[model samples]
Target chain A: MTPSHTAESARRSAGDPPPAELRSRLLGALEGLLAHRAFDAVSVIDIIRAAGVSKASFYFYFASKQAVLAELVRQAVRRGHEAADPWVSPDAAGPSDPVEGLRQGVTDGARLWRENAGVLKAIVESWGSDDGLRALWLDQMNSFTDAAVTRIEADPEALRHLGGVDVQATAAGLTWLGERLYYLAAAGVPPFDDQTVLIDTLTNAWTATLYGRRAADGRPAGGAIVDGHEGR
Target chain B: MTPSHTAESARRSAGDPPPAELRSRLLGALEGLLAHRAFDAVSVIDIIRAAGVSKASFYFYFASKQAVLAELVRQAVRRGHEAADPWVSPDAAGPSDPVEGLRQGVTDGARLWRENAGVLKAIVESWGSDDGLRALWLDQMNSFTDAAVTRIEADPEALRHLGGVDVQATAAGLTWLGERLYYLAAAGVPPFDDQTVLIDTLTNAWTATLYGRRAADGRPAGGAIVDGHEGR
Candidate 1:
């Protein structure tokens, strides 16, 4: 078969043709570039070249390079939310344990980041003092954490087992920690990617802060899903 | 007095003005434009105009706009380290308690961030992946903590008052918590800037996590300084 024929067959087998949306393609390109380059080093020309789209197409979708980055950030946050979707609201009910939900959030966060190391790393590590970017990132983060807060709020009784924890602060802290953790992994830092250490460190740190004296041994046992559990 | 005369007088009174450093002057100009404009929106022209330097001069000092930013980040990190210097190696052989030393570290960290918000925000919020920047930031943080850790190690007995807390992990957590706290403040989110709240939340939060309970019910209880005493 010709190369075109082989390409068509590969695409056909995949169920759907590749994304035609300029936005998706651009985001993909941006994500790909970020894996190896910091935000400051990459130029608009680089992004357009990597996207394999003309400058006109890129401008049609985004006003500037920064705009593409903003969208990239939004996409990463969205994926992070999707990661946590499985554990609490969808999987269990009635005083559902947040422990599993949290673990899934961390795991999914790690997975999405591993997949899109380029984009997430660039955005998280390259904060600027400009008010616009600051407002945009904070709003995006607030929205992501708000969804998590709403889920927990939906079943107030679900968190009742959490006792006297500052639910709002706890949720916020966990979300930030998850983001920072992913950033660390994307930066090629090991030990953080040590699934066992990650889960253990995160679980112990957060649970102890939330439950207090309950996780002192650095391990929460009994329905624990503790450190020894497979990270996958 | 002529405008030049006043400027000269101001310089003279400020101390024999040192000869202007070329790179620093360019970096300052770059930062001024950046502080007012989004990172992507600011261009070589704006930077040169703001600095009153030719494009050639700008290029001579820095390779790219991003390099200007990287330099600014280094400067900010340096300042942050200076802000925390007072507590890094305190005169006290060690605190009467280990928690106090951690407390000093966090408090010093908050002050440093507050003192240097602009560049700190830039370094912390990059949209592109920057291993170099992350490594720079991590190095600055580790330097500060390593100083504190040395002090703590000097008196293991003082650190031991915690009932066997993991000294190294505890130190890392303290540094991380401080960085995270200041990040919220630097975000320019209102209510989060309340200096008292910043100090109180970080100090109490660090105290609780390390010692199993916040020093004063999450409220500052007459810290040594009058202003940083309570976050409420």
Candidate 2:
């Protein structure tokens, strides 16, 4: 089967909106190109050629190459939110232990980043240079931070020891930390690319910030999870 | 006085090499432009016009706009290393408390990024897209990681609790985490710009990963610093 077959399968499985066939095709082409080349170096001609679409068609769906990138970033954000559901959803029966739930979230988030390294790398690298992309990324970060705040607010006991910490700002900082660390790791930046180290380091950070220690044994008094035995 | 006159003053005070006047002019121009616009958006004509130099002269000291960025990144790295001197210098009498030394390093590093936000933002945003910039950043990261490794190696007790963690990978991960977090903060990315939250969250992460807890109060029993009183 051809490459469009994969896109078609993904589209069908995800139940994309009607009339999005061409848009998905263009996105697929951009993804294919970005897989092997830096986003800045990939031009409109390259994207159209890779997508097997005409210039006019590309414009019909995207204002410019950056628009396409913004769209890709939007999709990445959606996937990221979905991946974070296991941990962020307040009602979800997440891992019995809060720390385990956070670790699971970190693992899933890292996997999502590894899978979409190309688009994520482009989005991260374009953070400051492209306002549209930056805004899109910032929007996602805000959503993640909000979810983190909710998580922390819902479980005051889990974070009671972090008495003076500004939960909102703390959530925001940790979310950005995760975003940057994962971007660096996914982009194959040295030292960050090692999956085990990257994920564990991130989990450790998240746990320490939210749970107040690296492990249950290391936790401070009154900072223990409700069901610490479930973590293992 | 002309802009170059100011640059000349900065050069002399900073002890820049002699006969590098024009080069400094172009760099100053680039810095001025970057402060107002993104690096990729700034053009060669813009640099020359801002510097009051001609095209040929622009090419005299730098091969391209990216070359100017590389120089700025190089200088930023040097400044970073200098800022990190208190923490990374092998022979220096660093903070008597390991956590205190780490906190001092994080604070100084954050200050350096805040001071050089414009150029550092460009370098970080250009990371992956430009080989030269990426190499420069990667080199700085590697050096930071090496220094971190050395510190950890030197402090067997402070980090003994982290027995299972890969110290090298851990160091690399933390270094990148700092880089990305600082970039976002300096670039004024939402939720990460709060100095107090960002630094404390980062310090918490670093401390947790290295010493296994959020603070001296929570530090693993056997992982106490040689002189905890000095930290206060």
TM-score of each: 0.69, 0.81
Off by over 4 Å in 1: A1-52, A61-76, A86-104, A126-136, A147-167, A190-193, A214-232, B1-83, B90-104, B126-135, B151-170, B217-232
DockQ of all candidate complexes:
0.23, 0.30
* iRMSD computed for candidate 2: 9.1
**Tens-place lDDT digits, model 1, residues A1-232:** 3455332242234546555565776887877777677776788889876766678888888887878888787777677666655543645552244554455555666677777777766666554534455567667666666666666556544355334334455455556666665665566554354444455455445544543432333232224433343321
* Cα lDDT of model 2 by residue, A1-232, tens digit: 4576533343345555567577898999999898888888999999987876779889998999999998888888788887787677755887776777777788788888878888988887776777787788788888888888778888866456555545676677678778878887877775567665666677767776666556433222223223343233
B1-232: candidate 2 lDDT, tens digit per residue: 2433553233244444366577887888998888878888899999988877779878888998999999987898798887786687644887777787777788898999887888988887777788877887788888999988887888875467565455776687778778877877877664467675567767867886777556433234555333211110
Query: In model 2 chain A, where is the ten-residue run with the lowest total lDDT?
Result: A218-227
Q: CAPRI band of model 2?
A: acceptable
Q: Which candidate's DockQ is highest?
A: 2
lDDT to native, each model:
0.59, 0.74
